[model samples]
Target: MTIEQAIDSVKKGCKAKFDSTVELHINTNLDVSKPEQTIRVSVVLPKGTGKKVRVGVFASKNVETAAANLSESDIAKISKGELDPKKEFDVIIAEPRFMPKLAAAARVLGPAGLMPSPKSGTVTEDVEKAVEQVKKGKIEIRTEPNAPLIHTVIGKRSFSTADLAANFGEVMAAINQAKPSKAKPDWIKSVYISTTMSPSALVDIPDLA
Candidate 1:
């Protein structure tokens, strides 16, 4: 099925009481063990993710307008299990200098997929811009730790099919652009779209080479 048809099918199949998140799942052929084959990058969906994102910033100094300003002590607390970042924010943006400090909390944040990294544009000198991007539907896409599978929320079940299709196109474009230099010409193996409570609908994979 095409993206539009798949999205329509999934939306029709949604039976949850509340708005459900539409997700895109892709299977790839690259072996992630090779550093160059790893795919990790952030892309802004033009139509947005259809949900509010709570952004937290970790910096040496306070950022006046940041949703949540995290300090060195907060990082320490997270490393020691005294703080649970997941309960506070949906996304975390960090300054380059603070990355070393975040390492201690990696054991805690990594598994949750909230750890800030340069590859995902979460580690940068400009905290404000990063926060804005995230709030405006910027999302990180990466393959799973032990598999060549990529999964992420594309939009909401309530969104129009056209809007959902637009967001899906942007994600695919980003993924294609991030294709590793050494990856095979045909990197994507399959594509599927589904809402949180619905069965997945297999869709034709775009030309991602």
Candidate 2:
């Protein structure tokens, strides 16, 4: 199916009571065992993710605007298992100064995938900008640890077909741009679009710009 048709198909197949997320999955030709062949980057969708992101910040300097601002003491508590970050925020951003302090909590945060890292734009000096990006649909797209698959959400079932298609295009464009220099032209083996509980719809690979 074309991208638009697949988006519409998935949207119609959604039976969830809530607005189900429209997810994009891609099977690639990359060899994940090679560090250079992995895909790990954050992208801001043009049409947004159609879901609100709860952003938390950890910084030495006070950032009143963060959804859940954590101090050095709070970091200590999280490190010691006295705090459960999963319950507090959907995304976490940290200032460079607080990174060392955050290491103690990596055991708790790393496995959860909420530990801030410069690679994902979740660790920075501009905490407010990072928060804004996450709130505005910035998402991390990465291939599976041992597989050649990439999975991430594009938008929601409630979004218009055009909006979903646009977001999908942006994701494909980003993936293409991030292709490993030595990868084959046909690096993307297959792509699928689906809703939270809907059957996946195979999609024709859209032409890359």
Candidate 3:
């Protein structure tokens, strides 16, 4: 389909207001080794999203429970007054000061968009919610600088085209709103949207005026 057709079909079928203009940022392509494309979005269905991720919290208490039991691929431990946040675990629990330790893993996790925080309720007094959301179909996204390659899912293929299109639009909006403070030099460089087996079809967003 033509780019305009794809955009219009997505907009109309989704019942979205025109305020959120469709966008197709340009002039960005980077080697996979060091992807210049910074933005990524991945979507998943509500039911078939796979096993829930187990979040291991590193806070107080003296239990030598097998770290293996932690639902995520890794585990972290933060002391009562530490000031560092390592690569974010599926869940995090520690003295607020230890948040800095995450600097080391920020480049790795931040770009993957896995750095869970309080706003998302991952860094809260109650660690259970963090665990719960991870298990649910919580779509994760990471945006590339200058490029619009958001890694997100549109859920199972059983979903109707309209559902996928509307879901896609919602995620794009979220990424646009989540621009980092450090990205002032040039927020977006290019746009590429596609699904699991498809080629990276370049995006052509209109001025919308």
Which segments of candidate 2 are over 4 A away from where they belong?
206-209
Model 3 lDDT at residue 177: 58
Candidate 3 lDDT over residue span 1-209, tens digit each: 44434544444444333222233323323332444335443333344233334445534332233122222223232232232333434434332433466544455555544465655544554444434555565555654544444444444334454554555565556665554444544544545444333334455544211
Q: lDDT of each prediction vs. the true structure? A: 0.89, 0.88, 0.43
Q: Candidate 1 residues 1-209, lDDT tens each? A: 88889999999999999999999999999999887898888899999998988888997677766768988888889988898888878899999998888898999899888899888888999988888888899999988889999999899998999999999999999998899999888788899998989999999765333
Q: Backbone clashes in each candidate structure, one number apiece?
A: 0, 0, 33
Residue 92 C-alpha lDDT in model 1 = 91
In angstroms, the error of model 2 at 187 is 1.4
Q: Give TM per candidate.
A: 0.93, 0.94, 0.46
Q: Where in model 3 is the C-alpha error above 4 Å? A: 1-54, 58-121, 144-149, 180-190, 207-209
lDDT of 2 by residue, 12-49 (tens): 88889998999999999999999999998888999999
By TM-score, is 1 or 3 better?
1
